[model samples]
Target: MPRVSFAPPSLCLTFLPLLERLLPSLPPTVRDVDVPPLFREQFILSGYRPVDLSWRCYVLSLFQIHNETLSVWSHLLAAVYVLVRFLMFAVQQGGGILGVGLQGPEGQGFSVDVSSLPLVLYVFSAVTYLSCSAAVHLLHSEQTHHSLFFLEHVGVAVYQYGCALALCLYSSDTGWTQSMLGQIFLPVVAVVVWLSCIICCYADLHFHRPYLWHRRICQVVPMGVAYLLVISPVTHRLASHNWTNTSTLPLHFLQVALFLLSAVFFSCPVPECFSPGRYDIIGHSRQLFHILLSICTLVQQEALFEDFLWRRQALVREFGEERLLLACASFLGLTLCCVMTALVMKRRTHVQLLQEGR
Candidate 1:
């Protein structure tokens, strides 16, 4: 026989068998996988080890099939859906932020300056969708346990930030005057308290940081309760019988509650999380969150639209032009936030990965 070329024991004896056993299929279960020699050699030469990269890649691999594929596409499609709706609204009612409204006869639909309000509202809603979409895609791809745990919350933060901005704009536009009760609670204080509650909830989930024995009092329950306490009073005032044309409390309260509920749904992760791998590719917590979020966004748009109509018909009808323009601005901001956040995160992750690769 021809002389056999000597192979290194590490390569011949160690890695060959492992390679034969692993990596044949795209979505092979890898919780207990052995490192192949080629990859191991790369690691040794680079003086680094796999830092959950494989798992991250593996989890993201679900995009090809498994459970999370539908989840990913669901939000991706939802983003597209929102974009279409926003565009339709813009086309039907032309004018930029601060535009004139439709003032024509009943049949004509000729308008005054009710333009900007729609656009601005659209923008805020778009931001919410984009942030949510990015979070889903990124987390799905995140294989390492730590990556999943850390990046997951970022999505919620994005969602909350968008809502906060929207609420702030509403507060200013409608001149949500502070009452004595509100003075005692304060907007700034409310925000701080909500943020604190959110942070505490996240800590409980990831860090297993302990809390009071009353389980119901922990996590989302506390958040919901705190929300009611801080926001309810103002919402109640807005909805109170004494109010007439301008108060935006009832609609605002409804929108805010729905938004909060969406977040809670995301955090609690019912149905799928309970089933685990059964919903890995579809019907997962993230997917449900996306659906609820979309509905919430649509509801919010309607609420904002109603507010705009009220403002034009009754409150400060003088600036129909300005209101329209403001709406457009808001729309642009919301739509852009989604695309912008995705690009930013992509760039950041790419840079970090490249640096790590080096």
Candidate 2:
């Protein structure tokens, strides 16, 4: 034997084979995930880093005080205000409609036999407000991308549904077919078209591009044409019948056009592609568009009510009472359900995490 020396293998050499195996088995990094090229371009334009600490938690921590804090609180306060208003309106309307000694719209004491239309409408308004508030507050603490994305999409639908419900209630309260063109019957056809567009757009998003081309060709494009055509005849009838004064026609047309334009803008985001971060926090095209739309809807509410009152007075009286009670109960129930589900999910997650720690 030369020197009879024995030496252990080096640690690095001993683990080299295992390390090579792991290199081959590991998945790609997060940056390597397949995202759209447009999105990639947006990221580059944003000048945002993948590893930078997000302001999300800081923003959420300000549930106590900050700009967004007040914004959140403002929406919540608005929702509460709406809820209170609904309660008051329901009490007043329900009492009258149920044949109790309740004051009617004219302050005359009469036996109210109308179904719950007034109450239902109020509840609908309250629910809409609540949904908005919930959406706003939730924007901060989303933690995960999916939650925010889904919630935003859902917010649009909720807002749309609220608007539609409010309009339908106005129609029911006054009269659907009693207006100038409403009476002529094409309004129904127009409404059907408009509603079909809404359904198609919502379905496309919710179902992930169902009947994509068909929706564009059949529902969306047709809806646009139908909307324009229906509006002309209806406006003409309204003006001639004195439902709306002739002098108001120009103003009304402008208002209607504004809403239609807003909808189009919202459906298609423009000018954001050039400068993405410029609109990241505020002044986004869609936000401005929605604000304008909400205003337009509020303005049109009166005209809609006038038209409906003339046409659907009997239907209003019929469902005015029962619908209210049912809706109030439904609102309370829904609120409770949302709260409970959120709480239960939170608790379960916490419990699971704690057990894992143990």
Candidate closest to the true structure, highest lDDT: 1
Candidate 1 residue-wise lDDT at 74:
58
lDDT of 2 by residue, 195-251 (tens): 543444343333322223543454346445544543554444444555345433344
TM-score of each: 0.50, 0.44
Superposed by TM-score, candidate 1 places the C-alpha of residue 346 at a distance from the truth, in angstroms, of 15
Which ranges in model 1 have alpha carbons more than 4 Å from their true place? Answer: 1-63, 98-125, 137-155, 164-234, 237-269, 272-286, 312-358
Model 1: lowest-lDDT 10 consecutive positions: 39-48
Model 2, position 258: C-alpha lDDT score: 74
Please list the residue runs of candidate 2 whose C-alpha ends up more than 4 Å from where it truly belongs after superposition.
1-137, 140-255, 274-276, 302-358
Query: lDDT per model, in order?
Result: 0.47, 0.43
Candidate 2 Cα deviation (angstroms), residue 161: 6.5
